[model samples]
Structure formats: structure tokens, C-alpha cells
Target: MSSSWPYPRWIAHRGAGKFAPENTLAAFRLGAAHGYRMFECDAKLSADGVLFLMHDTTLERTTSGRGTGGDQPWHALSLLDAGSWHSRAYAGEPLASLGNLARYCLRNGYFLNIEIKPTPGLEAQTGTAVAHAAARLWEGAAVPPLLTSFQPEALEAAQAAQPQLPRGLLLDSLWKGWLETGLTLDCTALVCNHALWDSSSVLQAKSAGFRCLSYTVNDEWAVQRLLDLGTDGIITDRIDLFAPGS
Candidate 1:
């Protein structure tokens, strides 16, 4: 048999995404119900160093709060209604911690892509905290998480904290020296905005021993394009629409 790639090619973005409050347990359940074996979520430290899930720095968009999420300790932040903003069906779902989500995924044998979304000016510290926490949480697992980040400092810190766990560098634009940066950071994958990939880009990355992944691809054309380029992973918000197993 061929070697087993630990991650699935299809990853559910922010759990089930628009179907539920992003970065909540409800979202993860929804994604799993839709047959996703792999999920992606943003992680950041609370004021007290608790690793919780929230995409934006502020809670205005995704939670029922008005200030910076990373500014509050878990005792306060954990109680905020992270779901009502999405829909009443999930009115009071609690903000989930990385440990909470980790238990669910580990028990069910699911894979994860943890994007290190640090608070402003805390990139390296946040990366170090999340990496250390993940290393502890996922101890003895068959496959570790694929840590990723757009911030170079965060990925660099993650590498320093836990070099054994694989990592990916997220990119929205193919900035100059991205290849060298990914190599320098020792990333196993390059996760990009879907439109960034083409024949040469994919070949260039693959030739350097890096897997190419794309994010938030919702349209059929985008999916087809990534498939054509032999992309390794496709992180999407359309878990309800995409057939994960197929």
C-alpha cells in the first residue's frame, strides 16, 4: 500500500462555517455530520493564555461581545454567546476552547488544521503557546495537526516550540520570497488563496517537497482548478455543499 497522508484533501473551514457560528462546537458537529473527516479552525490565546477558537481579533462579528476577544480571560470570554449571531437555532453555544475541540476531533478520529490567529503584537508568544498546548493535547495521536499562519513570526515561533509537528504557511498573495520563507520556516505545505495556484506555482512548490493547499474555495470552477493543479488540500466554508468523501 502507498503511504498514508494523514490529512484529508477536503477540509471543512471554521467548522461548518455559515451553517453555524464559526469556531464553535456546533460548527464542528455540523461539519462532521456532513461527512468531513478534516476541519480547520482559528486558534488564539485568551488574556490568561487559554487557547480558544475565534477568527477575528475582535468579537463584534462572530460573538455577542464588543471588544477584543484575546483581551479577556477564559472565565469571561467563555460565557459569551458565540452562536446567536449566526442563527437562533444555535442561540447559546459557548465559545469553544482548543481543548474542547481537540477532544471531539481526537475521539472521532478527525484531522485538524489549526490556524494561529494571534492577538496583535503577540504573534510569537501566541504561536509558542498554541504549539506547546497542541503538542500536549495531541500526545500519542496517530496524526498531529497541521499548524498554519499568514504571519511569519507566528509560524517561526511554532517551529521553534515544536519542530516535530508539521506546519504550513498561509498566503493570500504570492509575495516575493514566499518560497524561501516557507523553506526557512520548514513548512511542509503552502496554503494559499485558491486563485494563487497555477501549473508553475504548483510544480514549483511540489518540486521543493511542499504540498500545495488552497482555502475558502466555494465555486465549482475553483475546485476544478485546484484539482487540476494537483492541490493537496482544499479548505472550504461550503461543508454543506461539498461532498467530503467524494
Candidate 2:
């Protein structure tokens, strides 16, 4: 792994994961209040191609709206109650756009990791759009947001669209040609499930010119193991439990 990693060691997942509404601005604020400087969020396109923050393909789980999120235009999607599903405290929280998130992060001088979560068949298109939008949004910034995705096609499209922005390959398993794929895409980091990283996996990723990172690591043992393994970054849901910069 390179020694010049610029992001924080701890990143709040989906803006705070279970603490607030996943991928909503409220969750991001909660994560920030807990002292997290870096955050991870899922980005996908609306029917009209507006980039927005959301985790699921369907809105039923996290919002009051029904049907596929990508099937709806931004005007309609923006009106959905994204936070009420979590709790009444965050009721009426509108869906957050990529522009809104960019403004918030830039104002706070924070870092971001945006996962290119495309709706089913729109992976390549969504990836391209997100990359272009992010390039414009973060122009002239010192640290560009790290673009990551489990889909190679999405990452490939993002790379083709914005070569300057850093990218990472997210893996839940050590699939065939995983390392070769990361190398092919010119990924800056290899973000894997926390359990996937051992001494061997760490060495393999680091030796192949990619920083090692873990996702959704919440337990004390998982955090300690990654630290002991000398990983570069950790994405976690327990923002309240793990203090950033400690």
C-alpha cells in the first residue's frame, strides 16, 4: 500500500448506518456530530439522471415512497420522506442529492467515499454520470472524493469518465481475478469485507500497489485486527463507538 493515503482512518458508513436514516443528510449530520471527518454513501441516478444518495433499488425499505427509486424523476423522489422510516425525530427529511452532499462536505472540509450504486441495468450510465458530476462538484478541491463500487463495469465507466479521481474496488469475497481486476481499473484501494482481511490478503493487496480498506467494521476485535494488519482505512457504522483520529 502507498504511504501517501489522504483520507481519514475511520469513515462513517452510509452517513451513520443504523443511527439515522441510511444515505440521508440527517444520518450524515449525526455521523459528523460523532466526530467523523470521512463518510461513505451510496449514489445512484434518478429517472431524469439526477445523482442522489440512496442504498436500495427500491424505496420501500427506507422511504415512504414505493417502487424503484430510479424509476422516479428527481422532482418526485425529492419529496419522499427518507427519514421517517428510521424515526419520527427525522420525519419529513427529504431525499438528498449529490449536490447537497457536495455542498455539505465542502463546507466542512470533509472527505467522502461515494459508492457508485447503479440501478440494475443502468450501472455503466450511472457510473459515468456520477463521475462527471463529482468532477464538476469537487473541482479545485485538495482531496477528491474516492469513488468506489462492487461492479467493475461501473468502476470502468467512472474511470473512463473521470480519470483524475481516485477509485477503489469493493469486494465481499475474494472472487476470481479480483486483484487483476483492481489492477486493470487502476484502483487506489482495495476495500473488502472486514473478515476478508488477514495477513495474506493484506500483503496481496498492498504488494499489488493498492491500499487496504475494510467496510462496515463495528466490533472491537474487527477494528483491532485491521489496525494490527496495518490497513489504510475503515468504514464503520458505529461512529459513536469509534472516535475518528484517535
Candidate 3:
């Protein structure tokens, strides 16, 4: 049997391009409309312990709600207009919970890369909640979403809670013994910022039998370079730039 990971080359960032309300179902649908079959989203826990899609530490930037996201209850967070900040046309777009996103993706045969964006002190809680929720949401599906995080503690907690789900370690830059850190967390892949990858890094990850994926690549030349270097996948914000056949 082949032991390759199943993932699409083109993944929409935070759902669609940044042109839409990021992390909203609307953004995901927009990407899908543009022929994207895979998506990457940020997952975090609300004050009441609900796992939801969000990227920032606070709500001021992405939503009408105020204060830190970790300090607000789900009731308050859910009511905030998460879309209006992006554009007036997207006014009143609601926050999407992890459960909702999982259902949407699974039902549509879409692949997902769920990045665990836990609040500083709530790594364990966020990991546990996300894993458990994913386990429940994707029950009986053909393929489960890939869980990932930059936080080692969060990945550890997620592994302990749900070992069946695949996990990846996200890195902004490589540090001393980065391979050891990935091994410690039992990651199946290493998702890094685009500029950090080179032929040596790709070879090292391949030698370790781990998939290498790069994020936020939007240019044609960069994509071509990554492909030439044998990257397993490219996570891009320019969803319209490439498709299954293009």
C-alpha cells in the first residue's frame, strides 16, 4: 500500500482570499466556488470553552466584539459581527464554530488543515477541545482533517486526546533541533512559512519521512520554485491562481 499523505496542492488561506471575511463559512464557500478543494483555518477556544475558527488574540481586529477573545464567553463572541470589519458587503457574518466548519468540509468532500491557535495559557484546553470536537464532527468520514499547531504543548495534548488524527508542526523559522521537536510531538508533517524552505530543508524532512508544506505563497514564480524543490504542498492565499487542472 502507498504511504503517502492525501492533501491538495492549492489550499485557501483562512477560507477564501483575504478579500472576504477570514475564517467565515462564506470565505470557504467563496474559495470552493473558485475551485479550491482544500482549506486552512485557524482554530481557537472561546471563553466558554467552545472551539471556533479565529486567528487573532483579540476581537478588535476581526470582529465588532471588544476585549481579548479568550476572555469572552461564546454567547458574546458568537453575536459579534466577524465579517463587517473586512468589508461593508460582508456585514453581519457570524463566527463559525469548529463543529460547523468540520461538518461543512466533510460533507463537501473538502480537505482541511486546522491550525491550533490557542490562547497563551489555554494551549492544553484548546488542543483538547479541538481534537475532541473534530473526532465527533468527522466521525465515519473517509478522511479526517489534519490538525496542526506551533505550540508543542498543544500538539502534545492533542495527541494524547486523539492519536488517530494526523498532526503537523507549524514553524515560522527553524531553530536548533527542530527535527527533534517534530519527532517529540510525533508530527506527520512540517508546515512552515515559505521563505524558510530550501532544498536542504526539504531533503531533511523527506529523509525523516515527514511531509513538507509551505504557507501563504501567492506568486507564480514562488510556487514554481517550491514545486521544483519537491514541496509536498503549497498553502496559498491566491486561490484563483491555481486549480485542479490549472
Candidate 4:
């Protein structure tokens, strides 16, 4: 990392964390309302190659549709009630396309962290398309969305597609060769699982030239620990409990 991180210290996870339906425009709006200037969401490509916000490969958990979400074209995917599963308050909220999200963020001057959640074998394609779309969407802007993924191949493809956009390696574990992989991918940041970041791990990542970030950090103690370790960012689901910029 260049020690020149531009993102905020607090990021609202999946929009407003667990407060609203995750990865929806409604969630993002709620996140913004709670004073979050930066929001994180998942992005995947539909069958027709349209980029949209969705976290799972299958739609049963979060949307009204069944089977793989990527199996459907954008026209069909757009009609699903993505919010009904969450609660009646959010019933009938359509799945939001990346284009819709980009416009919303750009218009409001908010930052984004887009996790490229590709379907089972389309990692490279999704990464390439997302990078190209992000390049076009945030062109000439002061800051670009931080593209991140657990799949190194996807990040590599994204780098090959649009090297101008910053990339991060998401780690659920500090697996063997993790550091080398992040370096090879030209990552600007290393986003690790919350439980993995100790002082030693933070030092290791910082020494290798990468900003440290954690995900789904909710409790105040954990937040305090991360801050004490001097990490660059905290991705949290507690938008109500942990006010942004605090």
C-alpha cells in the first residue's frame, strides 16, 4: 500500500448493515440517512452481462426468485422482489443494478466498496465487466470505488481490465501465501475477517505496503481494538450503534 488511503475509517456494511434489507437501494438510502459517507455492497453479473447488487449465487435466501440469479437476464432479474424476504416493510423492492447504485453514489458524493461476488464460474468475466463499468461510471471523479474480492483470479482480471481502480484482497483466513497473493494482485488494501487481525497481522500487512481493513465488526470492544491497532478501516453492520466518522 502507498500509505495514501482515501477511504473513510467507518464503512456501512451491505448498506445500512442489518437495519435494512442488505444490498438494496433502500438499504443504501438508510445507510446514508445514518451519516455513513461510505457503503459496501456486493456486485455480480446477470446472464445478459448486466451488473447488479446481490450477495448470493442463489436467490432463495434474499429474493423472491429461485435458482442461480446469474442464470436470468437483466430483464427477468429486475422484476424479482428482492426485499420481501427481509420483511413486509420492504416488500416488492426490486433488485438494484450497479448502474442504479453508481448514479446514486455519484449524485450524493458517497464512496463505495464493491465486492465482486461472481457466480460459480464467471469470476473473471464478472471482474472484467465490473472494472470496465466502474471505470466508466466514476470517470473523472475525485475518488473511485474500491474493488475487492476473495478470489484472486477475479482481482487479477479486474487489474488487467482497469488498473486505475484500486483493488483489495478479502481474506477469511490468513492462508498460506496470502501476503504474496495480495502483492501479486497489486492490492492497495487487505480486508481480513474481524477475528484475524491482531497487532502482528496488522504489522505484517502494513509492512508489505497494504492498508488493513476488517469486516462485520459490530461490538464496541472489537471496534476499540481495531482502532487501537491503527487499522485503516472498519466495515461494520452496526450503523445504529457505531456512528460514522466517530
Candidate 5:
């Protein structure tokens, strides 16, 4: 690890992803059981200004609830069954709040990569809300969670809200203006798609003082490629496949 870099090399996607119902407490516990020290999960706001976990704009995919998740308050969103959609064993699991996750991860010494997933037309609001909430929740901690987003406006809002917390710009492709956008946002790192990094691009980003990371890297070939490039971090859904600190 670099001197200024203070995060794990491997981060569990949405807290164990395919292994457990994602974004729930059960998923985080499962990730810990699988020996993951750092986890990546999505964070967005509900109608009532509460920070909660949910990846999609609608809840039908992960939770039993339907329609827009951000339209409902925490009181309604928390009671829904967020786990049963995956399996019967995790049937009654309820949605967890940002505070709940913070307490659990802090108590057990785990790191977090919080992806600010905003609802449509509310990107800036969601990013600022999540950042402020994370800053408050992680108060007095030695290190704060790394906030990331594909939306530059959101990341900019996060930077404005809490400059102390580190941020990363997520990119699915090497757009023409991506490097400038990340630098403009004052991000500490750039998280890109697995295939986005190569020998040349990795060197360029590193030389420019940007830590490069890859996401959704679940295969051996992808892992080897990233390892060869000396990428800073890897987020994967295959929690059981690649052991942390290996």
C-alpha cells in the first residue's frame, strides 16, 4: 500500500453480492465471514432524508417493495423484506440504514467503499446527503469511507459537502473528458471498469497522481491483468473466489 493510500486491495461488492442478499446486514455479515476486510455498497436517500442502502432506482429487484425507492421514507423502506428475493433462508431481513452499517462495520474494524447512487434528477442532493451522513457517522474514526460515483455533479457536491473524506470517480469507459473531470472534482482515485486499465493507461494515471481501481473483477484473468498493472483496489462479487490479502 502507498503511504497516502489507506484502503484494502480487495473490496467485497455490495457486501458479498451473489453470495448473499446485497445491501442488507446479512450480506455484510456474509462478507466478513468470507474474510473480506473492506466492502463496497450503494448509498442513497429516502424521501424522508434518511440514508439507506439500495442499488437500483426501484426496489422490486432487490426488495419486495415496488416503485421508486427514493420516493418512500425510511419508515416504509426499512420494514420491507430486502433479502427474500434471493433465497428463503434470508427471508425476513430488513433494510439497514447508513448508521446501522456504520456501527456494525466500525465495531468489527471493517472498511467501506460507499458508492453514491442517486435517483434521477437528484444526483447532487443524494451525493451531499450521503457524504454528510458518512462524515457524521464516521466521526472520530481513524479513516473515513471512500466515496465514489459515476456522476461528476454528485462527486462535486460531495467534495463541497465534506472535503475531508476521500472520493473516487467511477468510470465505465475512458471518456475524453474523464481525467479532467476527476481532477476537477479533486478525487483521490479513479475506479474504472475491469477492462479499462492497461499498461499504458495505468502508468499515465499513476504518474498523474491518481490511484487506479477496477470494479466487478470476478475472474482469474481479470485479476491477473489488474495485478500486473499494480492497480490500487479491486471490487468483486466473487467473495469466496479470491481471498483477501492473498
Candidate 6:
């Protein structure tokens, strides 16, 4: 990461960190209410080629809809109650398209970090579509959303589709040559599980010019530790625990 990068320190996970329906517009609003100015979300294309927010391979976990999310067309996916599973108060929360989410973020002046959660065998297509959509949506905005993915093929597709957009590589472990892989993809940051990061890892990533962002961190001690290491950002589920002004 550059010494003068302009990203916020705190990022909300899957919208409001599981308080609201993950990946729904309702979650984004809830997160904003909790003073989160930036949010992380998963993006994938439905069978009909429309981009929507979802973190799982199947709809069984998060939606009232049936079947694998990747196998459903946009029309079917849109009709699913993406929020009811979380809470009845959010019963009608519709699946959010990338275009819709981008518009919301731009209008509200919120930053976004979109994780390309492509379905198996659709990695390249999903990445290209999401990146292309983001580029078009944020064409005139002050800042475009950041893109990241665990799949290198997806990141490559995204990069090829929209060279101007910034990207990050998401990792769960410190595999051999992880740094090299990140560099190969021209990623601006390395997004990893919080537990996988340590002082040495942070220093190595920073020294190699990659911003370090740890995910799902909710503890105050963890936050302080990352800050002490000069981490670029922390993505957390506990939005109320680390408000923007706090």
C-alpha cells in the first residue's frame, strides 16, 4: 500500500455485518445508520447474466428462494426474499444488483469493496461482468469501488475487462508465493482473514507495496493491533463497535 492511500480505516462486512440481510440493500442502509461509510459485499452473476449480491453457492442458506444461486435466472433470483432469513422486519429485501448497489453508494458518498464471489466454472465471466458493471456505474463518481476476489482467474478477468479499476486479492492463508501471486494480478491490496495476519506479514506486504486489509475483525484489541501495524483497513461485522467518528 502507498503511504498516502485514501481509503477509510473501517469497512463493514456484507453490508452491516450480519445484523441485517447480507448482500441486500437493506443491509447497506443499516450499515450506514451505524456510521459505516464503506462496506464490503459479494457479487456474482445470475443465470440470466444480471449481477446480484450473494455469498453462498446455494440460496438455501440466506434466502427463501430454492436452488443454487448460480443456476437461477435473474428473474427468479430477484423474486427471492433475500432478507426474510435474517429477520422478518426485513421481509421484502430484494436481491441487489451491482448496478443498484453502485448507484446507492455513489449517491450516498459511500465507498465499496466488492468481492467477486463467482460460482464454480463461471469465474472469468463473473469477474468480467462485475467489473464492467462497476466501471460503467461509477464512471463519473468521485471514487470507484474497489474489487477483490479469492480466485485469481476472476481477478485476471476483471483486470482485463476494466484496467482502470483497482483490485485486491483475498486470501485465507499465507500460501507459498502469495505475494508473487498478488503482484501477478496487479492487486492494490491483500485482503486476508484477520487471524492470518501478524506483524511480520503486515510488514512484508507493506514493504512490497500492497495494502493490507484484514476481515471480520470485531475485537477492540485486534483493531488496535492492526492499527498499530499501520494496516490500511479492517473489514468487520460489528459496525456499531467501530463507528466512523469513533
lDDT of 4 by residue, 63-153 (tens): 9999999999999999999888889999999999999999999999999999999998999999999999999999999999999999998
Give me the displacement of residue 22 in model 6, in angstroms: 0.7
TM-score of 1: 0.97
Cα deviation at 143, candidate 4, in Å, is 0.1
Query: Is 4 or 6 the stronger prediction by TM-score?
Result: 4
Q: lDDT (CA) for every model shown?
A: 0.92, 0.93, 0.88, 0.94, 0.91, 0.89
Show model 1 residue runs off by greater than 4 Å.
1-4
lDDT tens digits by residue: candidate 3, 122-222: 99988988888888888898888889999988999999999889899999999888888888778889999988889999989888878888988999999
Model 2: ten consecutive residues of lowest lDDT: 1-10
Model 4 bad stretches (over 4 Å)? none
Per-candidate TM-scores read 0.97, 0.98, 0.96, 0.98, 0.98, 0.96
Instruction: Show model 2 residue runs off by greater than 4 Å.
Output: 1-3
User: Candidate 2 lDDT, tens digit per residue, 57-116?
Assistant: 999999999999999999999999998889999999999999999999999999999999
What TM-score does structure 2 among the candidates reach?
0.98
C-alpha RMSD by candidate, in order: 1.9, 1.1, 1.6, 0.9, 1.4, 1.4
| Of candidates 3 and 2, the better by lDDT | 2
| Residue 47, model 3, lDDT | 78
Between candidates 2 and 3, the TM-score winner: 2
What's model 6's TM-score? Answer: 0.96
Pairs of colliding residues, candidate 3 = none
- Angstrom error of the Cα, residue 107, model 6: value is 0.6
> lDDT per residue, candidate 5, 134-205, as tens digits?
999999999899999998999999999998889999999999988888778888899999899999889878
Clashes of each: 0, 0, 0, 2, 0, 3
